[model samples]
Target: MSALDRSAATPARVWLIWVALVVALAVPIAAAAASPLLAWRGPVYIAAGFAGIAALALQLVQPLLAGGHLPGLSAYRGRRLHRWVGALLVLAVVIHVAGLWITSPPDVVDALLFRSPTPFSNWGVIAMAAVFAVALLALLRRRLRIGPRLWRIVHMTLALVIVLGSIVHAVLIEGTMETMSKVALCALVFVATAKVVADLKGRAKRSASP
Candidate 1:
């Protein structure tokens, strides 16, 4: 292709990437916004619920950012943004649990302690723990003396935990999120992360070879 053709295509490709991401993230939240259940909930509960939806949607972005799959973002910048998004994700999870605690401390305690009757509760707690572990490792990366490739592997593994656990937790809950959109979001997250992890693993293997 000529320089003119390439230049013309670049902006369009960037827009396409961004437009798709926006649709993927926004549809679930939009579905939740229309949910009839929100009318029965209080302000705190609604906020907390949306925070969770936000967190779930943010999961899709994390792998894309980390893999530098999003257009117009370099690998370094994307990974930097990935760290910030990870922090925001933690904050969302905190709000989710804190709000639930405010409404029902015993339930939240049971969930955290792995004593909850609901199966989703256990998965949620497990996912939350993995998230915290990943964040702590990222913060202490230098202090822990972990190499970059090893760090990526650990991060990817924990990230898979977070994504899968969150999927199960959300799917099992009969709450605000619209069913189809929620499932679609989860599938996209699964695919995106799987792609990134596969690529990273392939690169690692090639690096180790002659």
Candidate 2:
């Protein structure tokens, strides 16, 4: 195939990917927005719950950007976006927790302390901590003078914890998110993370060889 032929298809592919991702991200939010549960909840509580959903949606996007799977984004731009999205993910968690705290300080305290009765609360808190850890690592990665292997290991370890914890946390809750959409989002996050992690592992292995 000529370069022109291959180049002609790239824009179309990029557009399709962007549209599919946007729809995937929007589905759960639409489902949650339609839920009857929100009718009785206060604004803060509703905002907090939706923030969690937003964060979950972010999980799928992060890995795609991190892996450079987004066709139109240059590597430099992709890395930059990954950083910004990572920051947003952290912000979303803060909003989720803060709004919940506003709604019920005691419950938030219990969850933070790992004393919450619900299994999902434990997972949520674990994921929240992992989110903060990843953010901190990113912030201090250069200052800490960590070795490349160690940094990747720590980052990947925390990434796995965040993904798995968030999955469990979302799955265990019965909330505004519709069942089908919630499950589908979780599945997409899992696949995207797995693909990126596997690719990273292979690259690491190849780099280690002569």
Candidate 3:
């Protein structure tokens, strides 16, 4: 195709991808909202569950932003948004656990202590720890003067933990999240994380080649 034709096609393709991503992220949340589960839970519990859901949705966006895959966003802007969204993710997790604690102190305590009867609780706690570690390390990055390579390794490793642990935690629980929607969300989260990791690795390999 001619350069003009290719140029014209590019924006349309980007817009289509953006719309698809927005729709994919929206469907699961909409399904959860329409579920009977939301009505069954009290406000605090509902808030907690939705907080977790919001975090999961943010997870889908985080990697895309970090990888500069979202059209029209410069890499700098994307990374800036990624940092802000990371902070928000941490806050969502805090609200999720705190709300659950208020609703059932014993359960929250057990989960934190890794003694919860529910397997999902253990995974949630693991993910929570990984989130906290990531935030803490980010804050200390400059102070610690971490080498770029080391920082990327640490960040990506924790990211993997966050993605996997969060997915397992969300999937194992028979709670506020509707099953089909929850599954769909988890799948998308995995895909997003995998794509970013793959892209990052490929870039690293290219850079390393003589």
Give the poorly placed runs of model 1, Cα more than 4 Å off: 1-9
Q: Which of the two candidates, 1 or 3, achieves a greater lDDT against the reference?
A: 1
Across 16-87, the per-residue lDDT of candidate 3 in tens digits comes to 979988997888788778878776789999889889998888899989888777776666777899999999
Give candidate 2's whole-model lDDT.
Answer: 0.93
lDDT tens digits, residues 41-72, model 2? 99999999999999999999999988888777
lDDT, ranked from best to worst = 2, 1, 3
TM-score of each: 0.94, 0.95, 0.92
lDDT of 1 by residue, 122-189 (tens): 98898999999999999999998999888978998999999999999999999999999999999999
The parts of candidate 2 lying over 4 Å away from their true place are 1-9
Give the clashing residue pairs of candidate 2, or none: none
* Model number with the top lDDT: 2
Ranking by TM-score: 2, 1, 3
